[model samples]
Target: MRRPTHLRLLAACAAVAFACSAFAQQPPIERQMSPEQFKAAGLDKLTPGELVQLNAWLNRTVEEETAKAASEAKRKVVNENRGFITFGSNEPIVGRIAGEFRGFGKGRSYTLENGQVWEQVDEARLAGVRKSNPAVRITPSVMGNVWYLAVEGSNTHAKVRRTK
Candidate 1:
């Protein structure tokens, strides 16, 4: 009788192990819930076909929402850093230079009021010029990463690179 009882215990343990493995292979919706919660939600009474359909709908919804969120995040980042980062937009970045503007010189950095910093990359100069808080327009090239920074009320345009 004791031997029969021990055999029954071993069989019950094996059955539990098999059930756990099967549960591990189920969808996230089913795997995430405890047995009590599944029964309480009446999901335990769902047929296998119903469970599959529910999991499929959940997966599609999650993927679509995730994609939308990722796209919105990317758009926000690009909009906020339009001056410093390029996102294939042809619109020129227009802003005022913070503090005094001593004109453009090679290797000089210009800090914009929007907190973007650009360095003059080419040998462009505007001699005998001084202004305070002058507006600037930084235009991108039509087919490349090259950008030109032009000061307001002047024809002088300097080739520039984002430094910060």
Candidate 2:
């Protein structure tokens, strides 16, 4: 005799429950962020008084986002410079360095700490160290006819010609 459809459904649910329980015994993933970091990450763009409000909003957003059953909780921020851009994954203000050029040239590469490498072209070499042993932070600046790229985490800087 064939079993009832409801009984089959009940067995399937039990099997799923058992598998989930078994997986739950593993260690939880660890991730944490500090408030000082949040503030240092361009959060100062907003007024000091507005920080609390912003923090609350971020917290609620994170909570609501994390509770979604079918969502991937990954966040990234990207900033563009004259001919360069940097990317940060879940890290405030600290981003990965990247660049492209119209006339810099070929066969030029910048090497960072741990042997991470990037390429420079044309007049980019005049800007001093293209890449350093340690990855550098970059901020935007202008000086007369030259455009400056200031490294935040270090004292290194690069100057490139302004096409526009």
Candidate 3:
């Protein structure tokens, strides 16, 4: 029932995003003209009111572009060479644990083979769990500095915090 509305909202946002990127703006006339050409065209002799309007438009353009750039940069994935994991990013980490996978329990920290450390923060205990070097994945939650760890075969999971 709610899926349709959610999909519609997603489609609308995607359309808006596509339109914004598709409409590449041409350089304003103020920037395209050389100083000599601008002076020759008498644009340099504008009234005070007209000059103010031109400056205002240019300033607004710059501010809007800067804000858009910052917003787009937030969605970028961090490079693997930097730290292999990005804080506050929704990217998932998948690998085997350093030791045997005895399943999730409260107040436990599991070190993955990739040299990342995640400490269980919630009381989710798995029954009948025993494996060696089982694959695991830690996914970031919507909130900052929060994550959930899930083993490869079990539906059980636990809230975890990355210590390293």
Candidate 4:
């Protein structure tokens, strides 16, 4: 469901970066404006050195603002995907199951407090146990996309995949 939104955000960031590079070769504000418009704006009176300084300032400002926007976009994406295993993160996802957590069973779905839903995919069970909002640690396999969900304080783990 969220894959489209992530793609769009990534595309928008790429577009912004491309646009910045397109303007990189022509950073002079005077060139972007017509000669008549420049004179009308009273920029014609500025000395050559003053024009160079102005262009430099404009470039710096654009770079700074673009960097800030990119940083903010990245933060939003990371926050929105708190429960899922993101790229470059090797740590396990730690959170409590949302409600009554029965012992793990194949095909059972578990919802986490961080709004992630995971479903058991393999035959791993912990029978005759129940807990309310139990803390869980979902860790990714060292070599594959496989992830395991383990209730805190237990040695048993269930193979799972994110469903939401």
Candidate 5:
């Protein structure tokens, strides 16, 4: 009985080995050539029109990739530097504000002037004003111990108080 069992196990092992060998004898699935290989294989011998189309396609692909990378980098920068506002007493307010504001009031809190702190506002509400009134200027003014902001325009002269 022990011999018969051993022979059965040996036969099974031999069958498995034969099956594996038979499978290995077949050819593997062919892989597509890389872009370099394709070029080397005379793909570069395309017509002028085809070359133009290829160049345009390549340029568009590069542009899309570049734009995606730039967008991701900008997102990372914004995430790293969030909830903070940079203001200049003499600079234009419109330019001081970022193109698209995100991550505001998400990390830390801080104040701007004497008691004026940063607040989160919807982009849509601010977008129209920022676009239509692009020349608005914000400046810090001190009255005794109180601090105030002033808005100026192109046609308007300086020293005109717009805010208290």
Candidate 6:
């Protein structure tokens, strides 16, 4: 009985080994060169050394083009974000008030000298009467589209949002 069991285990191990070796697939190449591609490029007739050179050039070209495409894509994202009127986190704006300042008591809107219109979103008000065309700054906080607006030198600020 023991001899028969040992023979069965050996047979199972041999079958597994045979299956693994016979069904093993080739590793994928970084760049594929199919038979049709080889024929199209007339690479099928190239000498071994010349074929090696062609593959090297193709790999380099693919790498450079991939890197260039990635860079352009990143630039496009940044430009698209910049074109919008919205302010991103950490970005700040400084400009003169377009008209006489009334004061933000219960959320008011004001047009800056630069033509940007902003509205206060909170109940924070100014202490003193802001004169005509006072320079103001609106800066984004740690996160979110929420911005804080105040006079150039005043500590008082209000949570505001862009209207136009």
Which candidate gets the maximum TM-score versus the true structure?
4
Residues 1-164, candidate 5: write the lDDT tens digits.
33453455456556555654554443311124576876777756877787667656765665566556555654543332222222223332222222323222222222333322333221212122222322233343433212222223333212321121
In candidate 2, what are the lDDT values of residues 1-164, reduced to their tens digit?
A: 11343354446456555654554443311113365665567664767567667666656655554444212211111121222222222222233444432222334453323223434323433333344333343233332223333344445345433221
State every prediction's TM-score relative to the real structure: 0.62, 0.24, 0.47, 0.69, 0.29, 0.47
Which pairs of residues clash in candidate 3, taking residues 3 or more apart in a chain or in different chains? none
In candidate 2, how many clashes are counted?
6
How does each model score on lDDT? 0.79, 0.38, 0.69, 0.82, 0.37, 0.64
Question: Of the candidates shown, which would achieve the greatest lDDT relative to the real structure?
Answer: 4
Sort the predicted structures by TM-score, highest score first. Answer: 4, 1, 3, 6, 5, 2
Deviation in Å, model 4, residue 64 alpha carbon: 2.9
Error of 1 at 41 (Å): 4.2
State which candidate, 3 or 6, has the greater lDDT.
3
RMSD (CA, angstroms), candidate 3: 12.3
Candidate 5 backbone overlaps, count = 0
- Quote the positional error of residue 19 for candidate 4 in Å: 5.5
lDDT of 1 by residue, 71-124 (tens): 665566565555454579998989999998888899999999998889999999
Of 5 and 6, which scores higher on lDDT?
A: 6
Candidate 4 segments exceeding 4 Å error = 1-27, 30-47, 75-86
